[model samples]
Target: MRLIFTLLLATSLSVTGNARIFYLAPGGSDNNAGTIASPWYSLNRAWSVVSAGDTIYLRGGTYAYTQQTFGYMVGKNGTSANRITIKNYPGETPVLSKGTGYTNNNEHWRGGCYLDGDYITIKGLHFAGYTQADNFVWSGLFINSSNNVIVELCQFYNNGGGLILEGASTNNLFLNCDAYNNRDPNTGYGNADGISMKFISAGSTNTVRGCRAWENSDDGFDFFDNNGYVLVENCWAWRNGFIPYTTSQGGNGEGFKLGSTNSFPSTVLRKLTNCIAFKNRQSGIHQQESQCLTQLYNNTVWDNGWDGVNFHYLNLPHTFINNLSFDNDIAQVQVSGNSTNTTNSAGTGTNDGGWTVNVTAADFITLDTTGISGARGADGSLPVINFLRLASGSDLVDAGTNVGIGFNGTAPDKGAFEAGGAAPPPANQPPVANAGTDRTITLPTNTVTLNGSGSD
Candidate 1:
């Protein structure tokens, strides 16, 4: 009887042919009907009926009332112009999971929905309540043996192993998805990593952008055991425990953790830009392993429990330019263990722990031309740092070395701010409060200029 039903569904789908649209609702029909009123009940029914260039739209509701398994293989050489699209209707949230109150020993009872295809797009769906410690029971959306796919604008909350992209899945993009509050009922160790892209094979060129991961028990985002080019931009991670655990041996909970040693001979290059890390329990940002280039620019790291930028391991070269670190208890840049070949400089800072250089009038125009703005000391006033300024009676009007790093523009400036600084003024103009007066402390070599920015 089941075989006959499958054949009938396949035959109906083949008959309808190109560009068909089907709907899935609770306990609906599966006789190849495409209307929401007379929709198909299960994804399997829709899959059996959907052909190339077809779309399967799921209604906004809970599905799989019973413990049922639905495995759909996407990709199948679907073209970018005529690809298969599985999406939820606009302004609706659909959930796919194993039936409620059904717990299995292998953890496979939590909505084992697997995708094993390529060139497919799944968007705007919410997957939850799934639990899987090992690889058996997976998350709401498990993608294996797929490529050239995109999952965007979806929410994965309160599920086990939130979202897993494994099994040689390459060239996939996860955009603006949320994974949080997922817990493992069995071992009590689960991760709400907005997403975990595990490539057993070589998976390259993946992008994760505009995502928010907060308050998750595990790292907000983690990538391991793969040789891929990943770019994480404009993402925010706060209050997440053990954030970005790259590896067990040399992994520190950080706002952005990149590169790992889980798989030897697997080189990965990650680029992180325009991000902020503050008040995290661990380091604001961590980079380990060998030959991993962490280019951090135009970022703000302040008030972290540990060092603002922590680099460990060996041969991990970091290019840090034009970043601000203020009031961190530890050194702004902490290089420990056997790590080598690191370059650190001040692009900007209010209360930083480093060599204090004065910027003077002569050096100001020169340094400003080079893009290094004069230092606004603790007193909210500009100091001087130029070579000739020091030769004259000027305190720091000219007492800086011309051998420092240059800015993005022509010439070089002294202190944190270049000619055109990265930190912008706060929106919505408001009145400034004065803290009274400024006190200057004279040091042996260079005088310490105290500003309203407080202690570092």
Candidate 2:
């Protein structure tokens, strides 16, 4: 009977073709057919029929994971040509929430969607409002052993962890995602961060591009015991450790905690380029105990409670080029060892200026967020705001030297925002009909989900 059923399934697929899309809706029933008019209520029901080269479309509505269990697609593998995609339906936002009583005791239960599949893509969905279950570090999206995965344009709000990439997950890309207000009361063992990639071996290479992480309880971006190469670029981390929404306190609240809770080499070789770390409670851009080829280029650290750029006890030939800092506690840029650095200036020369001409916040147009931190440009890059722009007559306008990256006037602008660089062209949008690398499905497999939006 099982063989007959398998043959029937293959024959049905042959009649349709390869590839499909499944739809889910809040008002739908689990027994309903996974179709547009008759959508499946549970992601598990959609998973029962979905295969490689499939898309899962979740319609616009609130999915209460507590009332109805959270959705997850795990332990499935998709071939390169037929990657599984789970995303928001076109032109609508699918909100996933875990209200109170997800657990009676208030322990973290790894809420939201847990993904353990490889060659998958998750995009354009939002997760929020889950009570910690068993205090076991939960996340809106958890990816474990998932290689070649792409998670972009999703969001996390008020969850324990926004995104957790863990356990031998390799060659994944997370782009254009935002996280805020995620916290766990676990105190010293803080279980909250905008994003975390932990316990990953060197073989796991990941990249986060054009993302924003703020107001998280713990660090904005954290890597705990990741001996891997994770490149983070054009990202923002700010206003952490203090809840701007409420008068509550936050966790460590560092902007980018490159490596923590272990030795240095594990965190070395990770590259942070063209990133911004500001207004965090701790050091803006910090790394400790490293002796390897760690790279920091074209980054901006400002208004952090501690050192704007802190590289401590490192005997490595690290590179810091064209980075700027100001308004830090001890000093602007604090490094324990001499590094191969240049064009890095900070407050009191203890910053990136490194005994050169020291500049203050007076060099900027406005030290406040008058125009910056608004909407991004068409290309999804940082918006062109004068909030931190160098004045025409300011010394920082062209003080930076060429380091083989794009610049406006003479050199790169001193900080994350370039002085007058044009916004990059808009990237490819999703719900593609047909093309190479574009997601598509036939009439028989019309159920579909949105794919990720690409960023740099």
Candidate 3:
């Protein structure tokens, strides 16, 4: 009997020592234990209680706040082996909103949540209704000075800005997120971008992948004065620089503002891969005065207000390959300085050399943009759409110089969506499953548990 009691106690201690799970809900109380049945009331309570390797699951409901500066500031750090996770309860959406009665200041920045912690993962939460009366620079979530953070499967809308990463934030990832409908009324719809990563030092290596941004007042994705190596992959941006539900245009309006004018030249390093930009008010991809070498590969830009790609800042050693630029109001690609421009659409750079190809409406399967803003998949991936897919018999198929990235057929196609390669597959495919390793059990432990968590 004593041996059994000791074993049970040891098991309990081991479980608690390794990791813990907490719960948060709209109607919970700080005084109560943070169990699934009796959760905490606020994110602040969770921040005060959680530790490394802990997870806090927020329940479905609107968590309204009236804070003037920030609703919640998460400052706890986690280790590389075990990250602190804040996620919504499965199958439910938890929304964080800035309620009425919050003071608005144009000079100050307001945020619904501020993440200043390292090695954290925040997923499947919605940040909405965080706007000010004036043209205050606000964000649904602000990541400041954080490292090794992953913010995935989140939504940010109707805020002053969607998400902003700044101030020494390094090695962060924003994956499969959406930002839309963010406008600043007082600034004549200026200063509200879908996502902006600015003011970080070089070598930060922040990345954004599989994300979508649309209908923001300012640029879709802005890397303004960020002296870091930033990457944007498999992303889409459209209809930015216009007010939501209206034709009125505002702000700089570039779909992907790679970099703005920098006081210190050649400070930014950026790479774009498999991205699509369309219908923005300004240039599709604009690099203004960023004299650093940038890489543009397998990107598609069409029907933008200004040039498809305006890399006019005299940056040396830029690389433009396997890109498609079509139907912009200005030139297809307005570039200067030195670049390795090859395997792209005709007339892309000063010394363009590639297989000749012309893009027209007949070259694409569809250009309707109907399902661009549709619902995401169940696993929080972007919806697969037919927009901008190369037609079956287009000359662009297998016509690109391989830049070592993965490709199908003899060579990669010259656009964001590869002809029969990386183009999104049809919906409703069966999810693949995986069972964990096999284990042997003795007579005392005849029953053994298997881990299936790694299955998709």
lDDT: which candidate is best?
A: 3
Candidate ranking (lDDT, best to worst):
3, 2, 1
Model 2 C-alpha lDDT versus the unseen true structure = 0.72
Candidate 1 regions off by >4 Å? 1-17, 27-34, 71-77, 101-112, 131-138, 188-192, 242-253, 261-268, 278-281, 288-291, 302-307, 325-332, 335-456
Selected candidate, larger TM-score, 2 vs 3? 3
What TM-score, computed on C-alpha atoms, does each candidate reach?
0.63, 0.83, 0.87
Candidate 2 per-residue C-alpha lDDT over 1-456 given as tens digits, one digit per residue, 9 for 90 to 100: 011111112223333466787888878888888889998876767776777888899999887755423466655777777788888998798888865455332221476667777888888888887645556666787778779999878888877778888888889998888888888775432668898887777656899998888888888898777777888988989877775355366677788887743444434567888888888888798774434457788787887887787775545556787787877776787664656777776766464336244667777777777544466554456665566667667777777767666788866766666676565446545332322255444455433454333222
lDDT of each: 0.53, 0.72, 0.80
Report how far residue 405 has shifted in candidate 3, in Å.
Answer: 2.2
lDDT score at residue 29, model 1, on the 0-100 scale? 57
RMSD of each: 20.0, 8.3, 6.1
Tell me, by TM-score, which candidate is best: 3
lDDT score, candidate 1: 0.53
Question: Between prediction 1 and prediction 2, which has the larger lDDT?
Answer: 2
Error of 1 at 99 (Å): 2.3
What candidate 3 gets wrong by more than 4 Å, as runs, is 1-16, 68-70, 103-108, 261-268, 346-357, 421-456
